[model samples]
Target: MHRAPVVLERAADREAVPDDVWVELRRAARELGFSQIGVADVDLASAEPGLLAWLQQGLHGSMLYMERHGLRRARPAELVPGTVRVITARMDYLPRATSDGWQAIAFERLHRPTEATVSLYARGRDYHKVMRARLQKLADGLAERIGPFGHRVFTDSAPVLEVELASRSGLGWRGKHTLALSREAGSMFFLGEIYVDLALPLTPASEAHCGSCRACIDVCPTQAIVSERRLDARRCISYLTIEHDGPIPEEFRAPIGNRIYGCDDCQLVCPWNKYAQRASLPDFDARDAFDAPSLLQLWAWNEDEFLRRTEGSAIRRIGFERWRRNLAVALGNAWRETGDAALSRALSEAREAASALVREHVDWALAQRDTPALEPGS
Candidate 1:
């Protein structure tokens, strides 16, 4: 069920926030594993036109919720009445165990077609659970400092323009890939917000640092980054494998490669990500099975096994059918590349029990065994 918008009545008797509140909030946020915090005023009228144009261009694909929410996303005050300032928090999500040269390691996984590559972000506990709970704690700490104030916490859960809010408040500049990028933290962090009635001072916005660098746009598997900052989600492998619910589009299947959950190619190629910070909390550590599992290993999972392994994971939200569908596509890419009879046999075995959607992809996977394997980026 969709959650009703959280609207809190502003407290008439609320105490004036202390001038040192921002300093206190940052100290508290850091203790809770947040990398940085900033405040953004609620006026986002200037962003509406570009947002409307993106929606009108159908770049968001089947994410109809983006269309439905409309300008309310830009106007945070309308979504949460009396929301004067949005407290934006950034948390670096590179797993605690991630090592130096991790981007190279991730690129290596992409080259090994038989390996099932889950995006680093989805490898551990669901970020929604981790981020929301911490953001609520941050809000609670503020309430303790300045008495009770109307506030609501959010991660990626709502229609809020998270990147816009983060960028507006100095968390980072929007990178060419359209993700918030900081010189200190790169594009590998999660962003959360606390909408409050308190009138806090706003953080100054950061200036764009990506000059003449087209790495992110140039590296997209399907060229989803249509221009510098514009992404066509329809062609994006991450969207195709996750947000997109139907059959894998034919054109993007080969380029999708072995990425079964989400794609990290754009981030991997970005020059700034060498500075990507490791997650301070253990909540994002890569689970053993997902660390570098093979296509066959993930393919063997029955619905019950899929549920068991993906418990408390964002991957579970995609459900078992989509899970198998993605695996089938990845297995197909592997089958083409390796001409591995094991991949073909695995797809054939699952064909009978699969849903019509999965079976179609399974059949496609089996058919790929005879195709010539093209080199990556060919």
Candidate 2:
């Protein structure tokens, strides 16, 4: 049923939106390519203590922004003035061609050691751009229906507690690995939120389905999931490879394997991921460059080639230095696994022209030549 536009005299207040508006909003969100939308009240005071505890434990690693924002991350109203409710949305990001037994295929890549494995979510377009743009369009559609209203859209922003909002809004439950997961979609999705002044009906939070399931915790290469729902980002491969700008820690280097961008082992091991959905949009299709490219192939690219190839992709955000740093570490692991002499020669050649940081990593990688060799898949 098509409804007439809701005219408002000024920006919406807590009592402004009717129940039907919520229904229309969901319909519009579906039209705009979101898989689910849920409403969370602005009062997130209950989540503050945990947030503080995580920071106190220094679990956020070098992401000083988390410490700077502090509890403002929990309080939506403080982050965005006048926010009475938060609208959380999730978009399934698995590429359209992700086939059956995809998890096994991903696990197989770990055994090869030479093939660079970018995270499935990052194998395509930059999701930060895709989610933010679509979220804005969803907000604009809402405004067209109920007239202009105060709102802001956020996608993986530093100040937003996205997983909290997602869990509270029934989009999913918090997995033991600390990522939001749902029975319907598992953990293969991107989360975005819209903070608004309008009061919307809150969706019931989903029940935690990870009961007794420790697959994610056990599969972690670095044991980053220190405890249930508690992540030590400093030990996390995803954090080390992408967020931390300095040298890759020595202890975790061999465990990193071929994951050059982000880590997906936890998600790949989860039993529920058998039901993970494919993206409805073609924007997430994996480019040929990331389709099982080898460590040597990636190592061959110069800074200019790296920039040119990664122009529109999220991999570009890590920059050439970190990219090379991660590749260096993975190359070292590959040498240990296969004792490949070509990899050693490449690492040696790159070291002469490398920066101090990259040179240090390359030297470490060259040192791996003396390490005892192992059979593939061992």
Q: Which of the numbered candidates is closest to the native, going by highest lDDT?
A: 1
Model 2 pairs in collision? none
What TM-score, computed on C-alpha atoms, does each candidate reach? 0.97, 0.95
In order, the Cα lDDT scores of the candidates are: 0.89, 0.88
List the RMSD of every prediction in angstroms. Answer: 1.9, 3.9
Shift of residue 87 alpha carbon in model 2, Å? 0.6
Q: Which lDDT tens digits does candidate 1 get at residues 177-241? A: 99999999899999999988887888899889999999888888899999988999999989999
Q: Write the per-residue lDDT of candidate 2 for residues 134-234, one digit (tens) a residue.
A: 98988888889877777788899649989989999999989999999999999999999988777677899888998898999988988899999999999
After superposition, candidate 1 runs with Cα above 4 Å error: 1-16
Instruction: Write down the worst ten-residue block by lDDT for model 2.
Output: 1-10
* Model 2: lDDT to the true structure: 0.88
